[model samples]
Target: MTVAIVGDIGGTHARFAVWRDNGLEQIEVLATADYSSPESALAAYCERAGLSLGAGSAVCLACAGPVSDGDFQFTNNHWRINRAAFCRALHIERLLLINDFAATALGVTLLEPNERLAVRAGHAQADRPVVVIGPGTGLGAANLLPKGAGEWQALPGEGGHVDLPIGSESEAELWLLLHRQFGAVQAEDVLSGAGLLALYAVVCQRNGQPAQHANAAQICAAALQGESLATNALEQFCVWLGRVAGNHALSLGARGGVYIVGGMVPKFADFFVRSGFAAAFADKGAMGDYLADVPVWLVTAPYPGLLGAGVALQQAG
Candidate 1:
């Protein structure tokens, strides 16, 4: 197709779209398991849309897991997308493989000013770096570095695997609990979707509650509906999310700000905004004051990856 093909490939699913006039169209959600490779899924999207992809088409994919060189192989899904191979299969002339976290970071430009609700109300320097840390199927982290006036570069990162911060007694106990499972517990060890389920299992085990083997959605729903164990786990999740965001901000010196993205937190946006996120983010030891001055924003755009993919394709030319 003459039009651009863009996709945000997550651990579990892939969101694909075509863009025009700074807006996303023909958005489709497809199961990564439904196809053996990214190209098959792309072909299905085109067939379903009744559109034809011309040879020498252009494409971009913001993928889950890490991105290096020109390929992006999904972590959870069994798909390895090489730039050259992918370009050939899809008949794409040019393709940009972007890390999902980097895609979220790219949203700093697309995000409206009003969407950036000030959680800290700090004196932000426009040119200062900004951070993006989101917890979904896994933890995604990145930053936005200013290039020039009205221009910024989204830098991919893997800070999610860093050591987890031990704070409260409950948190300490959880760390010990996780140590028995995974040899070394990282920040994402207890922050991602599976992490939430792990936390809930620990809580259930400790309290002698029946081990309810539920998915992330069920756990979230039960928590929202007033299940004690699920509710407490959700609360702990919020606190930890805040602490992680704070740690990222301090490490990056993100005086421009920090943003929260991904699909997991959107459901609990109200609680997250009014939750311990702000407190935990500002709860650093010696740098508490400094971190307090850093602003934080929750990315509210639904199709940020679509815009980001366009940005990457534009930059590639």
Candidate 2:
């Protein structure tokens, strides 16, 4: 049997698995920092799985940031992929590359009911577009369009870099602060892991309080413990996330639904469910009613990207 390999490479980790019998096996995760390049990491994975690469093997990689034909650079990491060189080194018959969020969007199509938790209740319109957005090392967004007969197309985009929207006077004030600090503030500037920490510090500065948390995890811990500043920052984070997601939904007319997939939101699922996200999502002045009927789901699947890369590989074949 021919061997197929799929990978989901992010800023921090690279997840690899073998595609066999239409499912993933021998799944392994390696820290990106542990290896100098993806080729090295994949070599380690193959060693652990007792496999060899040759002309009979095929590989698909879901990578962070925009993908192109020749060479690619990761948005949040130092790794670079020279497509032709990689294939030459691996001696693979075929290699496919796609944006990571595009893979996540494809993964949404393969989700089971239990893999997702509903954040809003509404009916999803069949055949309409679906929006996939998430926050991790960076913010990512994509759209999934159903093409009928069980086929779907995933559209990748840099939606995370769009201008941050302001909904209220307080948010406007915050925007000014952010602009002063970072010049031009994009959604990713305040919606990512590092952004969360920055938001916490800015919130403290805005309120004349001393910032206590140094990272996103610490801020989340403080919020769950009912620390005032931490709670406020987290709330703002969810609200901004909702605002950005709503913008994407509006841009794409995503009546099929919105799937939130990432490492950040799931960590505070309860708080997110109760936060200002819902109100902010549907807060568009006139389009509020339209957005209210659009359902939103938080993806809880552990390896959506890897699964999606396998799906992409199958689709290519």
Candidate 3:
């Protein structure tokens, strides 16, 4: 049995779970703002669960930012950690940090059929590249390539920072307005949780209506309740998400398929399916036919990042 500390740290929330041979155990979620550092968060979780880390217990964390040179700079949080410092703080012998999207990509390979929601039933070609992108507190993306018959390597990249695409004249107008405020617009600007709020605000402003919701959750609720403006904003988000996924698929030649995972999409799977998501994904002019055969799946796994962190630890050994 391989017992290890596995975590998924995001902008607003951090989750820790015990990784065993069967699956994730003792899963817990903590507010990121409640703790000053990852070490403190882990300590709190351990105290609650009556668990302790041994001298050389394996630890792997999936963080929502770039990790390099044994250092992690959280994209949305203020925590700054070095591998050595973290080890000393947590009293762990070995620790590994991986990009959140990379972890999601790796976890996709281990998901069961019941854990996946079929958005598009296209052909998934083996040995081809796979792309994973999702919107949570922020947008995340990664690619997976086959290493061998049962092995794969995940390539993490800052794909969310890429320029947002505009397909219609109305969208171009909105982009100009947003560009004036932010200077440069990226996909994450209007594709994440905060992005949903921004989208609703902008759309409301454009329609000469006052903003309605205070946050993304409220906006999603209103949209589901048949609020016209909120629904419009949500639809736009889905369309844009689909377009971005298609772009990633084309760029990576992700014939193995594209998987959507994060805190957002799973909340309203039916809404996403009925929205303009599929149409936008296959709407690429020249590559439309090419992408039509590439499947897109919505990951419904309960704790994918934890699973990925466990996989990381196993692979390290």
Candidate 4:
């Protein structure tokens, strides 16, 4: 039987799986820090799965950051991929690479109803574009366009690097603080995992208090425990995320709805649901009504990137 390998490589973790019989098997997630390179990680996964790759086998990797010229470097990780070297080392017949968010957009199509949590109630227009945005080690964005029948196209870009939007006078003050620290503030600077911690510090600074939490997880835990500083930072995070997502929705006219998929938001799903996200999303003055009906959902499915990698492989074949 001809089999393939599919992977989703992010900044911290690299997930691998075997593609056979139209499904993924032997799925494994490895820490990127544990391996020197992606090839090493794959070899480790292959050993654990007791599989071997050869001339007829193929590989598809959904990687974070831009993919180009058969080679790419990850945005938030140190590992890099040279397509020629990777193919030669594994003896694979073919290799396909795609932006991680593009794979995410494709994966959104495969989500079951139960795998997503609705944030806003609205009707999704048939055949209209769908927006996908998420924050992990970095922020990622993509658009899914229907091509009739059941096919879709995923367009990925670095929407995360866009300038941070200030929606209030207080937000302008916080932006100035962030700008002073980072030179220029981008959405990713305040919407990602690290961004969460950074925002927490800024909140503490604004209140003239010492920041007690050291990491995003710590801050989230504190927020859940009713810590005022942490709560404020997390709430602001959700509001900013909603604003950025709304911008993307407007830019693409994504009336088909928006899917929020990422490691960060899922961590604080409960708080995010009740936070200022929905209000901020629909707060656009002239376009408030236009965005009011644009639905949004938070994806909770496991291994979506891997699933999308498999989908991309099938599409290529």
How much lDDT does each candidate structure score? 0.81, 0.91, 0.88, 0.90
Tens digits of per-residue lDDT for model 3, 78-191: 777788878887788888899988888888889999999999889998989999999999999999999988888989999998898998887887787778767789999999
Descending-TM-score candidate ranking: 4, 2, 3, 1
Error of 3 at 264 (Å): 0.8
TM-score of each: 0.94, 0.97, 0.97, 0.98
Query: Candidate 4 lDDT, tens digit per residue, 202-306?
Result: 999999999998899999999999999999999999999999999999889999999999888888899999999999988889998998889999999987888
Give candidate 4 regions above 4 Å deviation: none
Which ranking of candidates, highest lDDT first? 2, 4, 3, 1
lDDT of 2 by residue, 48-147 (tens): 8888765238898999999988688998888998877888888886889999999999988889999999998888998899999999999999999999
Give the residue spans of candidate 1 off by over 4 A.
Answer: 113-120
- The count of backbone overlaps in candidate 3 is 0
* Model 2 spans > 4 angstroms off: none
Compared with the true structure, model 1 gives a TM-score of: 0.94
Of the pair 1 and 3, which is ahead by TM-score? 3
Summed backbone clashes in each candidate are 2, 0, 0, 0
- TM-score, candidate 4, is 0.98
Residue 267 in candidate 3, Cα distance off native in Å: 1.2
Clashing pairs in 2: none
